[model samples]
Target: MILCSSTPHSSPETQPSGLYSWPNVFHVPKFTYEAEFELQQRNIEFETNGTYFNPGPKLKGNLLDGLAQEMMKYTNYPKDYQCEEVAAALTRAHPCLGQLGSKTGFWGWKQSLKYKMQNYRTKLRRLGHPEIRVNSLKHKREGQGKAAANIKKARKAEVNYIPLHPKGETIESLENERIALLSEVKKRDNEVLIKAKMENTFYLRRLEIVEQRPMIGEFKNRWPALFEESEVNAEFLRITTKPLQSKFMSQFDQFSDKLIHILKKKGGVKGQRIKNVLAIKDLCDDIDTRRECILKSVAIYLNEDPDSFFKEYLASATEDAERDISSTVMGIYIIRIDRNREPEDVGVVIEGLKVLKNVGSIILGFIMLFGLIYALDLSFPENFKYTFKFCQKIVMNLDGHKLNTKIQQLKIKLFA
Candidate 1:
């Protein structure tokens, strides 16, 4: 008689449908369920060339019971099985599988192995054995986390990775250094352009002032308010006087004195323009009374309306000045007066000063002050007061008696 162990390696075809083939020899073990599981974990072939797991002879009787007894020596008492731990233990049992890591076919053999373990757990429940489930929920969550990590990596890869510069790009060069260098270059270029423009403007303004200098000097000589006295003298002293074209400096030397006499005769206190005026005996009283009288007459001459004049002149001058400023300056940057504030505006102040210098009338000065205070509603009353006070001091510094007589005579001539 022969004895053979039954294991997963044993099958009817492989065993030849009879008793064990090893009758006189030591019996070989048959294939068992545990050995089959072990083979799957090791990814080894169970059958090859129409043979069982063991291609040699069939095993002896009841190999499954013997293998179970042998396995009990190293097996844990509880025997809780998780997918990876069981895979690791099986690989430990058979070192040949360790090099291959755990081989599954195409789609991940671990998933299929997990289903098998679930079924095994179900069987244990049916057998009235308490369930020994290993915690694989955390491992599943980690797998999902890995999938999410891959998705994030793919998203990051979708961004444009080409370098802006000619050289090969690093992360710092592509992201930070490129922008910083380009921006610095652009800013430096803009600054250079602005500096060039400012230098050009400065030279242009200097040229204009130099060209207009001769003409402006003549105006300053005739119109004292147009320039400071020291500036006028300094400019005029540098100018070389031209020689007389005629063959006589003596001829024109007395010409000015003679002309002054002739002008004095035609235009004097006794002229027809001042025929209604009388000389003042008391200088102080006449100055006080005549100042008021002259102002009233001048107001009548202006039609007693200064607002219209201020508005008309201010608007025109402001418009012209603003246009000139806008045309000369480039870009959005500018220096300008706010014309909406009317006479309080600096443009209006410029026009006023020019008009005052040309008018040369003390009465007109008062009128302008009134218009600025009342019509234009300039809020600076104290400034106006101080300005008029200064003018009054200047007037008081003059020969009051002579000035009073001349003003009275001039008013009568102008109004008559």
Candidate 2:
């Protein structure tokens, strides 16, 4: 069924059913939607084997065997039938033309037929069929052969030059001092802050590259099959079409439903009142999966990476909140804990809850706890407002004190 240039030739013992190699007949590659529509408007009839071709009678072998064998008769113009007329006749005889749901589907069918017909033509041309004109000048195009020869001669005549160094100094030795300095620079450039200072040009270029990264590029890289474009007609068919299929659009709908459910949930309050906190943690884990799926759906819809979409949303929301809004709804509490804190450290505290034995459950428990705090802030604005303000001041003073202590310690070290 699938036809390509790489397809192997059929063996003599297992030859294809009625595959004929005819001469002076070309396959129609651009027989597209417009051609089909024009043919339909003309309403032409197809004649095969001295009678009208019918799709009703099932062909013994392949569905297109009759068309491929008889197509040359119409194309050769024995009765002076024009190309359009031949196309109309061929379209009328096509088994699946009517079954095609849209113009694109019809065009795709025509393209497939065209490839099959081309393969047949190529097979015949290989057997020295005189009437079929194979392009003998493929490797000898006008001025190309002579230009290639000239390039080859130039390459043969060209000389290699090596830079001369002193007898004691080899190329590597000569560059050793510079290489050492370059290695040091490279080492310094490994960290982000140092790289920004040491390699300003490259750091700025990196920022620009990140900023200009296309949403479509991300989708294509992540889901290549879904976003892949046909090499032949990519401009018209793939690039021009948006929301490529119902499946893609359905993802957006599912995501919207998830967001709506999140907004409408009263389960958070009920789960909070439960004697067991593990039950609430399990629910949050499921909700997290739904949230992740929603993000993926949005990423596909916008033709962007999920990370980029999240970053852009956060940036825009922050901008809007700063520009128009006077206050923030969400409060962030930053607690300085051991940088090397392990899961086992939290496991002891959650042992009483009895629900978070595993590392995953413990992580989910923390997520639920934060989510509960956020939900309560929305529900009880009066209570959390003053509490958050006090916490904010406390954090500010703690940071200032920490900085002052560090400065005092540095002064003592320097003076001593």
Candidate 3:
């Protein structure tokens, strides 16, 4: 018998809306009380309800299967930290369910949940669930030979990461819709229709992205409407459930002051250089200037060349000079409208192509390009990979617990 449905125990006021609420750290499965009552009816012997007790292999399997089913409702590929959170919540709600001889008493359960989730996905794949089926071994390229490295699961907290087509909508139907959207975007005052059609064809878009892994230029050509400012923000919202520009800028602002102070405390030649960057006139007065200074300081702190990621060129620079800027990988270009005045625009260049132009500020350009990177599944530039990863794991808090050594060190100092 399915003892309990897999819904979460979220209050109406606390329930998330849209795509962006952070995953509740304390997710309790629905019907907790019912499950506890059933356990009591089983006449299990234990010193106390809060004490650890083995539910026997059969009962344990049933309970775990139920939990796995509940979790699969959210994501088939839960990150390690997500599994830990769910397991910890489960054991905390019913301590008797906790395993003895484990550090947190839920370590074993966490492992079981991971395995159970995998098994559940396997079953779904067999049944041809589009989302899971796409990642099946049979679909893998020839000579991959069981390496699982190329699995195209959601890396961020994407709610509709790889959804099935909308009801009654098949691939051909969605393709037709997508083609219609291309012309619709060119029409004036068609934002409403464009938005609806984009939503309708999301499944098809994701299938192509994951299956084909098209080049950035090719993907942009195929989905030209997706690169518009409004749609860029919209697509980001679809993927992460957060407003792209606001979330990034707010997080950057929140940490900017503290990050500067932390960098100031370092004692070395690089530290002096970072201080010099910070000492620029009106750095604190102008938000753009401050943001630029902070970015430069961070690169200096991390021992990376700021010039590698950021470039400045006169608006009337020679064709060869313009060509050099276009060839930059994951680069931000500051176009100086005049030598004596502030830059007129910032452009984001990815894979030697200008993907975003007329961006108002450096930080905004960074976030928008980051959104594009996620949307297009493009790899981060090698020189600044950790920096982007820092923003992904720390600022955005998606898969926040998994951090590399460099990001961990920076995070400690930023938070300390």
Candidate 4:
């Protein structure tokens, strides 16, 4: 009668698209097959304790059924079948078995499953849907297209007993194991610790995005900011995104540090020793394409957002009148108000007009056209095309050269 559940909780991970990852959020080590085997071994070591799982029948992968057979290996399941009491014990023992080995910790699989289900239900209720239970695979699409809405309503009106979902249990166990392994590795690996902490940081930002715009309009406005931030959030991204440049940098630093350490230990390495060091140095140089990548990124980012930021130095302040945003500002404007697109895209306006009266570009003609297009889209004061062309008529002495396909592609993809 004892029904054990084998659900363990998992930690959350932030997805790239800014979704919250709510995983199986708990741990239960004792319900695993290994834990049962250990418990059986422990009972024999204690001499007086009754036998544990595996003597009577083999497991069928179902934790509850397995626990039933495990109990009956030496004891009678019918006699021992007290679901509630046994479930409570499994709940208490599962965590300990995970921390200390199963032999010292002790829990039955059947009871563990039930306890896990109870814990899962408790968590789901905490998430605000008390009536909504984990959906079992067999029952997932159930009652959807059925003409039994009234029956479903009646079931809801009465006390309904929802079956525990096997997948949910599996998810929970997997989560617990993954987080436990991560925690164990963290003690020995700096990289794992860095990744774990970075994951938390990323999740916090994702939650912030959810708060700002759960709706489409808000998301459209806010998504750009998230995209921009993701570029520089952590070192792994920085190094990889910057590509072979960072790899070479790391290799160089490591080799230099090693060489210095070796030299300090012994004054100098000559002949064969020098050759070994040179080989390492050459290996280090092989990963050095990072500088070229850095130059390209610098050219692009600094060109587009000239006043924003650079890896070398803090970006020049927008207030610095002498700063050159001619290319960047024009690029922003062209993108936002090209071919009768809205002048009312306030982000583009702010970015374009950030420097106000100082746009010195060969494409200043394009800027005039851009403002006119925005005006036409907004029905502002005048016809933008006519006004700009008329102004061109008076000043530049040019007949007709407007933003065409080649210009559009260039302006949007790369800052001219």
Highest TM-score among the candidates is held by which one? 3
Give stretches of model 2 more than 4 Å off: 1-61, 74-97, 131-134, 137-416
lDDT of 3 by residue, 196-298 (tens): 8888888788889888788888987888888877888888778777777788778888998899888888788999988888897353488877877887788
* Location of the lowest summed lDDT over 10 successive residues in candidate 1: 154-163
lDDT of 4 by residue, 285-379 (tens): 43222222222222232122212321111123334322433323232222222423322221222223322222222123233223322211122
Regions more than 4 Å wrong, model 4? 1-46, 49-111, 126-220, 229-416
**List of clashing residue pairs for candidate 2:** 215-303
For model 1, how does the per-residue alpha-carbon lDDT over 1-416 read when each residue is reduced to its tens digit? 22333334443234321121112222323346655455554444423322223211232123223333222222212122223333343334333333333352211223433544444444533543211211122222345543123211101111111101223433344334323333433353354443332222322222223223333334323333213222222222111011111111233232323322332343443332222221221233533234433323232222232222223224446566455533321111112234333133222232223322222232333433332222111232331332222222222211111223434443244334
What is the TM-score of candidate 3? 0.88
- By summed lDDT, which 10 consecutive residues of candidate 2 come out lowest? 153-162
Candidate 2 on 128-192: residue-level lDDT in tens? 33223222234234665442231110000001000112345443553453233334443632434
- Models 1 onward score TM values of 0.15, 0.18, 0.88, 0.21
Global lDDT of each candidate: 0.28, 0.29, 0.75, 0.30
In lDDT terms, how accurate is model 4? 0.30
Q: For candidate 3, what is the total of clashing residue pairs?
A: 2
Give the true-structure RMSD of model 4. Answer: 24.3
